[model samples]
Target: MAHTPELSPSQPSGSLHRMTAPALQPTETGTGTRQTQLLARMLLTPAVALLFIWMIVPLALTIYFSLLRYNLLDSESAQFVGFENFRYFLTDPAFLASLQNTLVLVGSVLGLTILLGIPLALLLDQPVIGRNIVRLMVIAPFFVMPTVSALIWKNLLMHPVSGLFAWIAKLFGAPPIDWFNDIPLFAIILIVSWQWLPFATLILLTALQSLDEEQKEAAEMDGAGALSTFIYITLPHLARPITVVILIETIFLLTVFAEIFVTTGGGPGLQTTNIAFLIYSQALIQYDVGGASAGGLVAVVIANIVAFFLVRIVGRNLEA
Candidate 1:
């Protein structure tokens, strides 16, 4: 009789409320989720479309042009040539020289920047008078445009007869070296390194400041010398940043054209010609649009391969 007492309309049964509530919850949640997804897609559509227009369209046209025999110098319509353009570009002797020069430029710059950047970063991290001003002065080269930096170095710092380097050499009773003619690739590497060293130093200095002071202090207490402490503690902490620097520098290094274009002009033979300059030579100098298109695609492939490997290396370091 007690159990049979009628419940009030406002006081719903607990079991019925729990069952209905869960059922409504999933439905409401799913509807909200779908709306959020729709909104996200709508918001992303414009950027995705713009990206397609900018990047994909040019890439697609390059691919199409690679299959054609188009020449700026010729008045004839573009003719389909299959893969002959690619074959010709890959076999050109200039291409081989350019590839070699590219590798050497990239490797030497990476080495010099890493070797020099660490020390410079360490020095900047130390307590010094006018540290902010010194850091600003150090990073000033990075702000200089490639063309401008190339001109400055060519005219004011590396000129055999009148440059700053020449003046310094004369001060030391030595002849000024012909930077562009005798060692064009090395000169290119030096200019690029000068521009990028500040970037490396900035990143490394930030990493250094994050280092645990207690560890270094403890190492000092244990009689660990500066070299020993840096090698054992500091270097390992910097592995990730170094990898990041390598990845970023390699991407830009592969496409280094302005410095060579302004300074060396891929001149004194094919000594300083990298792949980017090679493409410019093919398209603008030779007027072979098809061959240049093929070269551009080849460069893209090469860059992708290098990027893939570097990304994998960086990923592994980060995970560790």
Candidate 2:
């Protein structure tokens, strides 16, 4: 072969030139990283800011107030009191009663809604006359304003003498029962369940609709009974939706205030006083800012605890 021409001095050796020619600049790499970080922050900024304003700010204020002997009525006379307010809330009989009532209300409502919702969902999903109208009627309660719903139920359905319950009792040749006095907590539970039942039913019905029809047919062909097919296939398919319903409903139910406020006002000797109403009473009625703040913190802690387990459980089920 003919001898190669001598390379120019300005040009590097072949391998060195290939390796060093126009490598990416450090400045460009740094700029790219900064751009990525900026994009991420830009995307997350709104949500993070909203969460801080909604949850963090109020929480910080509550914690600060809980540590002081502040009263809304006497704000100028607030004194540092460490955990006195917390101690008082934990020790007070009214607070204890309210806590118990809260548990009962939450438990009863959740149980009833789940018990009724699954069947209703199944039934609603079936081909039936007036299915669309029935579904609309079922979900209508959830859209009603909480206070409005409470007032309607209180005045139109439970108004002792003139309400539906009283009318039904009279039709049965029985004395009209005073719902507020004889069954305040149960009454609240019923109202809450009625509002939430549609939510659960809608969720489960959607879940049911998403199930594979072939699987059910195969199960039936394999001699599996209706209950067995439902238990093994349908229920398992509904696990995620059920968990979602439970989590969302739990959060809303824990903060149940308007219903109790309008319907019972935490009456019948504090039997209907859930934590939300208790906090309101402390801050607005009692004018005890510190005590209310302590109560608020407690409610937050309890809610977070429930939420944590719920998320974890739902996450695991989803993974499986």
> For residues 1-320, could you state the per-residue lDDT of candidate 2 as single tens digits?
23334432333234443454468576665565567768988999999999889987888999999999987877799999999999999999988998898888888888888889999998987898999899899999989888888888888998899999899999999998788889989888888888899999999999898889999999999999999998999899998888788888888889999998888789977889989999999899989999999999999998998899788986675544
The lowest-lDDT stretch of 10 consecutive residues in candidate 1 is 1-10
Candidate 2 at residue 35, lDDT?
78
- Write down the lDDT of every candidate, Cα atoms only: 0.90, 0.87
TM-score to true structure, per model: 0.86, 0.85
Q: lDDT tens digits, residues 55-89, model 1?
A: 89999999998999999878397899899999998
Error of 2 at 4 (Å): 57
How many clashing pairs does model 2 include?
Answer: 0
By TM-score, how accurate is candidate 1? Answer: 0.86
